[model samples]
Target: MPFVDIRLAGNATREQKAAIVADVTRSLVERLGKPPAAVQVVISEVSTENYGAGGQLVADRAPVPKMGEDANAAVTSR
Candidate 1:
């Protein structure tokens, strides 16, 4: 059995959560030869304020990036 623990900050949609579980199960099945039923995926959600980055806590802020923006542009360009 393969255990995968995912710690995410803030909220996510139900669809997003479901996708995560499915993807994790697939990864374990592919990488470790574990069956989908034998893979364990746990998700822990915490406040961004409790999760610090760059020595600063992420406050209640959500800057919705444009559809075309890449991840680098989304963070560094802010």
Candidate 2:
């Protein structure tokens, strides 16, 4: 049996997660000769507020738009 663990700083769509699981299982099956049913995969999504880097939380690293400001403008200007 093989165990795989994946952690993401943000969320993923259901379809994206499903594809990831399928791809990981396929890889283990092909590379390690493990049966698909014997392979285990776990996906964890950590909120930006809960994850930190460079002495700051991920949520705080991105600029939030002020009132009446365009959200895209804040991201592109950075």
Candidate 3:
């Protein structure tokens, strides 16, 4: 089984999150030969105030996430 945990700086719309889950599941199925039904995706959204980068809070340094942007760019993957 493959599990993908996603963290974002702000809330994501239902459609946005569905796209991510589908994309991740497809990637795992194609790369690792995992079954779609066996893959699991988790999403966690944190307030921008709780996330910081380069010694500055993300909310102060960048705009809120929009569709087609790298909202999960700071995520940890292994």
Candidate 4:
């Protein structure tokens, strides 16, 4: 049996999780010759307050860049 564990900082949509599971199962079936039914995939969502990096919690980390914004323009406009 192949066991896969996925950890995320936030929740994902049902479609997203379905895609993940499909891709993971495909990979395991192809590479490890494992049956799809024998593969185990678990997705764990961790709260930002409970996750940390570089001595700071995820909730206190730097902000992410906005989607569809140019890096240079975003910086200059800030």
For candidate 1, lDDT tens digit of each residue in 1-78? 788899887788889999999998998789889888999888988888788777767764545566887756767766
The residue-by-residue lDDT of candidate 4 on 1-78, one tens digit each, is: 889999998678999999999999999999999999999999998998999998999978655566976666655664
Q: For residues 1-78, could you state the per-residue lDDT of candidate 2 as single tens digits? A: 899999988789999999999999999999999999999999999999999999999988877787999999999998
Cand. 3 TM to true fold: 0.76
Pairs with backbone N, CA or C atoms under 3 Å apart (clashes), candidate 3:
none
List candidate 2 segments past 4 Å from native. 63-74
Candidate 1, residue 28: how far the Cα is off, in Å: 1.1
TM-score per candidate = 0.74, 0.78, 0.76, 0.79
> Using TM-score as the measure, what is the rank order of every candidate, best first?
4, 2, 3, 1
The whole-model lDDT of each prediction reads 0.82, 0.94, 0.86, 0.87
Q: What is the alpha-carbon lDDT of model 4 when measured against the actual structure?
A: 0.87
Error of 3 at 28 (Å): 0.6
Per-residue error (Å), model 3, residue 25: 0.3
Q: Write the number of the candidate with greater TM-score, choosing between 2 and 3.
A: 2
Question: Residue 35 CA error for candidate 2 (Å)?
Answer: 0.3
Query: What value does the lDDT take at residue 31 in candidate 1?
Result: 88
Error of 3 at 68 (Å): 9.7
- What lDDT, from 0 to 1, does candidate 3 have? 0.86
